[model samples]
Target chain A: MIISYFIYFKLQESDFAVTIFFMITVTEIEKLATLARIKLTDAEKQGLTKEIDSILTYIDQIKKATLDIDHTPIVGIVHNIFREDESRVLPPEDREALLKQAPEREGDFVAVKKIIAQD
Target chain B: MIDLKNLTIKKAHEDIKSGKYSAVDLTKAYLEEIKKKNPEINAYLEVFKDAEEQAQAADTRFKAGAATLLTGIPFAIKDNILIKGRRAGSASKILENYHATYDATVIEKLKREGAVFIGRTNMDEFAMGGSTENSAYGVTKNPYDTERVAGGSSGGSAAALAMDGALAALGSDTGGSIRQPASFCGLVGLKATYGAVSRNGVMAMGSSLDQIGPFAKTVTDAEIIFNTIKGNDSLDSTTISDTTYKTKKTDKKLTIGIPKAFLKGDGINKDVLKNFEESIENFKKLGYEIKDVELPNIAYSLPVYYVIMPAEVSSNLSRFDGVRFGLHKDGKDGIDDYFETRGAGFGKEVRRRVLLGTYILSSGYYDAYYNRANALRRVITSDFETAFKTVDIILTPTTPAPAFKIGEKISDPVAMYLEDIFTVTANLTGMPAISIPSGVSGKLPLGIQMTALHGNEALLFKAGKEFLKE
Candidate 1:
């Protein structure tokens, strides 16, 4: 499997004609997980590193796709749809219903983790 | 007892109108079947308690002479779609208790027509995976062979219809979510054009690729359900009026396009290819011409889709933060709260896509991955445009192979994504496609897919009806 990866990596390098050396290490996976705001366990991080490496190797073929069209217009639902910027008040019952979905609520306000603190 | 298996929407409507049976009776028959089969199949996450009440209302409409064709029909809804006062969990523990405060535009339209919803069907959590195995609830088993998957993110919708648990069901297609499962379960599934159906109430996966559609036992039944639920809704600005795409009935001589380069690939299963050829022969018997066509950029569709879809998924699913609704995990800090809540809430496949999407859209690699894929997406769209000028519809196998065992491809995400190879092109191009049961290999059924130009569903339905005649 390691040999296969090396050959595939070399082929991708030549196929896409890009000059960057690449390997999806565990540290990189941890960075991406952080960027995505999802915490992964140590074991999950290792497993995902191997899986993402294989996935990236497979999808690397897209870099090799030859495109003759510089910019073909996207073909569906391109019309500009505008709506009026307006505020509407919800009924009391509806307001209660919406507020009820919050994990924590104080009166009519949804409670959240605080970011600002007095020094 | 009503012969629910052989019942179509038209026959059911006629029977109700003629007083042969009431809507209450029909709903009871389906609810009874759900009770019997749902435990084993796990097709439905929750069967609605108000089904019979709604059917009674439909009976009132029929008596008042205000009945539409769907007035007394029972349909299954995928869990992602919001029906007010009902739970719409999307088969994830995060939203297992979330209830919609308002009905989706489609649900409102169906309600006006007096349709009965039996239950919310199970799905892949947040509509992430191909097989229903990724569902936080449980896997939906194929009715034909219980050991295998029902094929999803719309597996429950298709499985319920396949087992005659519901007369029809609604499903959303982001990639092959609808058609592939329909193919696997021997049902008809349609992925309508991008903006053809309003997405006001359906859960968003990939915004540009997702469209809600129907799954049923027959082509005509699928068409009827589609027509009832489709139309422009002012709430969803992306919707278009019926006249947006000028549709006309076709004559007997209809031309079908076959992308030889795509089908010529050795990766496709032989049984699937054989079944496709037999379908071609069947079309010839119907006096239609089958011609070879080229879609040069077609081979890149799956790769392009992986890039664009994950990017969109990451953006759309960002709304699931612990603040407003759904699961919340308290932590040491605000950022930790965000991390652990989402970490535990989302399924394994959902997390992978989100992270992959983040990687692609991040600064350094953005142009190399996401931007490149978007430009290639244009190439794919135009290929369909050029091909449609020559043929009314394009044909391919719905899946590369039939449904594999439950845990067959789960470990390797790439292998599971490959199952969508033949079906994602339509989504990438924003075109309408349908999958119909063509034939069977061994004990498993195979499906043949037909795609048409934007707003050309009339042609797809026309051809689909003729193809299924045998």
Candidate 2:
């Protein structure tokens, strides 16, 4: 059973001319949790459905902004700082120290569950 | 006993140089204070065991006559900024036992100055919330009033300084993290120009918005810390050199701009408004001109920040999947492992933001939300650009109100987010802003923020020194 919620945002351009609605549902929340790689219980999903709906509704005010003039995203002040291509080998002690942090480690490698399924 | 309450970095430097107190004696005093007050204030997560040794090293430098200003200065570092071999979990359970492999660039620079690091301070888990209530360890209580909170995600840093646990502290401001806490603790905080400080080795939040800054008792102390940690670094490609932005020249007296229309909006406390007016009057008496400037699209800053910040957070936090360095949980398969690990590791706010960011950056809503927010971001930057033509700096109350109770705004995420309304524009436009201690209201401290043109932190320091009469 999926519960759907709708948020109404009045566009800045002729408020009467446009009222756009975005719907967020428990199903959508589940899908988002999956994509975000976090497991949530049914109760958590339901709570997020309501909470995210309100937050999105509040932030949806950006839609009403008139960005007709040069809306290109500002990339910030500094750009295109290219450094010389260089590679340096880590010290053996440093390599051992880094490898020691992994939870499950093989000889010189971090071990993980197999992704490929076999017959 | 060292006069920790009135001790500034300059005074400490001179005292240590003049043999009034040795570096070890200073370190012992702070450690004693941390032991006495930390249990109640909950400011320090873990006081370093080698702090005395670090101070001894500083003393060695002093004996060699190679000491810098920061030598022997005890500092409290936010957990997000790494120190090699130290446990830097960012106050989250996910990385509870995780140790840093290398020093952060800022930490490296401070180490070169022979500074003594006291401990890792507490913060919001992954810096996802405005209050430190989101910390997995515990909440850092306000030093001024124990019933209330020390403003966060840099709460512990502010509380450390407010309680005289450390002479100065380092904090990362995604939006208002540093400034809000500084205001709450009656201290000065700075968020330098976005690229002015290198972000290398610091945990990534909103990549573009996060800048490591200092928390100090006075504006001059804050300026000294800023000078040491700021500069271009090859490790961080986004870093800017001294000449990255042309320095804007001003006439004899610098002009200050007040966004009157924006401040007139609702939700601002009456006391804050009164304090702001008094600040204006004080500046007027200081012989500087104040003008009302319009930021037409400035109201959109909060909404835009929500969109852009979460998007960047979703991307940046993806690295913490429990495989390489942090906590790990076992599951049926590789995919389930990620789900199980992240589900147990992340707190409520971290989960919510990651999910929201995933939703916003998802296929269907990308153009409607993320792109539109970016478009408005450009407009907001331009709004500030236009206003800077006449004003040397812009003034606003750091937070709409003083620090609230620990659980006051914890339940309501949006209400907590409103704490950054006045502080996010600096991040969006990549400007340098300083939050100086204004007069107190009731028992809580209030602060006024001054934002200068890009790469013009000198102007902010000058105005802050004048305003605080430092």
Candidate 3:
């Protein structure tokens, strides 16, 4: 089922003004789930479609915000901290301990399903 | 008996030093309380087996006359913070049975001070929800009213302290997680200025917004924990030193600002508002100047935070791809393997956020949503900067109301998100904020949050101590 979600954006100009409607649907949700690399059940997809639509509508209020100043997001007080490049090796036991937490491991390496296929 | 209910870290330290009781005795008292109250509260996921041993070491330190303020104190650590060789899942099935390979920087620092690790507390899965109901293990019930929820994603830490299961606890706040639960449990919680505390070894969620903080019975205890855990670390370059931001000179009496326009909005509980007014009056009586300040762009904080946090979460959580550690499920192909594993590993709320983040950062929506939100974030931050010019700190109710019932707002994500309205502004502005118990609403506890300018935690500490009369 396709659910039409409309996000209204009002744009103002000296000579003209207009409202733009953006539609989000189940197809977009499926694409998002794929992009996020999470498999969603059919029910979750349906529920999330409605939930995401509502959240989008709520957040759409930002579109009407007028940006009169230019500023980057303030991450923290300190910025551009440069550290010297150094190579440090973990002790063998510490490396082993870290590798031990892996679901599947072989020797010192984490094991995964074969990626490249051959004829 | 240790009189655990009336215990503070300073008093406990003095008692341990005066030989009133050994550190082992204190650890055992907390362990016994955990055994008794944990079943009902579900505060702790696993009580550390070596708690007594750790406390015994503290006793050794006392004998050597090397005891610090936190020495011999038993602490409940939030599951998201790593303690070497202990299970440190962020209360999610994805990381179930995972053990930490190294101690978090805060844990390492606490160990140096001879603090005892009682256990790891429960939290919302990946610190995602506003209530502990999202925990994979079980919901942590409020110690005051078991029928109600312990506010989350740091719910277990708050519940643990409220129940006297530990002397103090650690919790990470991303959009009110620490303060909300602290308010609900009648505790003092501090989310220090961003980068004041290192994030190394703590699980990432909203990298820009996440901050590891303390849940303590008193404002003084919270300050003690914050001082110990905060510093510049080589591992987390985002950490700050004492000299990071130039100190702001303040007058003899601190001036408190109330954003009247913002507080005039809808949905605030009447009792909470009444309690907030009472707190303002108390501040006045204490000789602190109270002023009305304007934060014109503050109303857009929540919307902007919802945009920026999820975008960061999507980028930060991509590391848990089922290849290296934690829970993994196999599928027909390599790509299918990740899909299957994450699908089975993550819970509903985690999945919802990942998808929402993807959509927000996706092409076409990136400029309109993410970039626009970042621009608005700066404006909102500047609003606080402007307000602080006239006021030393800003005050607001920690949450809109007291703790809600377990299943109350779980079904409605927006309602749950609304609980962080007053708390998120601090995170967005990268300022230090503390939530202290103001009064009680009905049977539940209420809190008043005080936010100070970036790198001005001393002002917050002073004002909090004054307000709590600590």
Please, what are the lDDT tens digits per residue for candidate 1 over residues B1-470?
89987898989999999999999999999999888999999999989898999999999999999999999789999999999888888998778568888898888888888899999999999888888999999999998889999899999998898888889899999999999999999989999988888999888999889999999888999998889888888877778777887664576588999998677645678899899998998998998889999887787788889998999999988888888888899988778888989999998999899888888889987877887888999888889889988888899999988888999889989888888888999999988999999989887889999999888898899999988881
Q: Every prediction's TM-score for the first chain? A: 0.74, 0.76, 0.75
- Report the Cα lDDT for candidate 3: 0.88
Q: Residue B238: error of model 3 in Å?
A: 1.1
Question: Which lDDT tens digits does candidate 1 get at residues A28-115?
Answer: 8999888888989999998888877777776677777766535433647557677788898899988998888888899999998788
Per residue, candidate 2 scores C-alpha lDDT tens digits across B30-92 of: 999999999999999999999999999999999999999999999999999999988899888
Error of 2 at B227 (Å): 0.7
TM-score of chain B of 2: 0.99
Worst 10 residues of 3 chain B by lDDT: B260-269
Off by over 4 Å in 2: A1-23, A69-71, A84-86
What is each candidate's DockQ, to 2 decimals? 0.45, 0.43, 0.42
How many pairs of residues collide in model 2?
0
User: Which parts of model 3 have CA positions greater than 4 angstroms off?
Assistant: A1-23, A69-71
Alpha carbon lDDT of residue B256, candidate 1? Answer: 93
- lDDT for position B36 in model 3: 94
Q: How close is candidate 1 to the true structure, as a TM-score?
A: 0.95
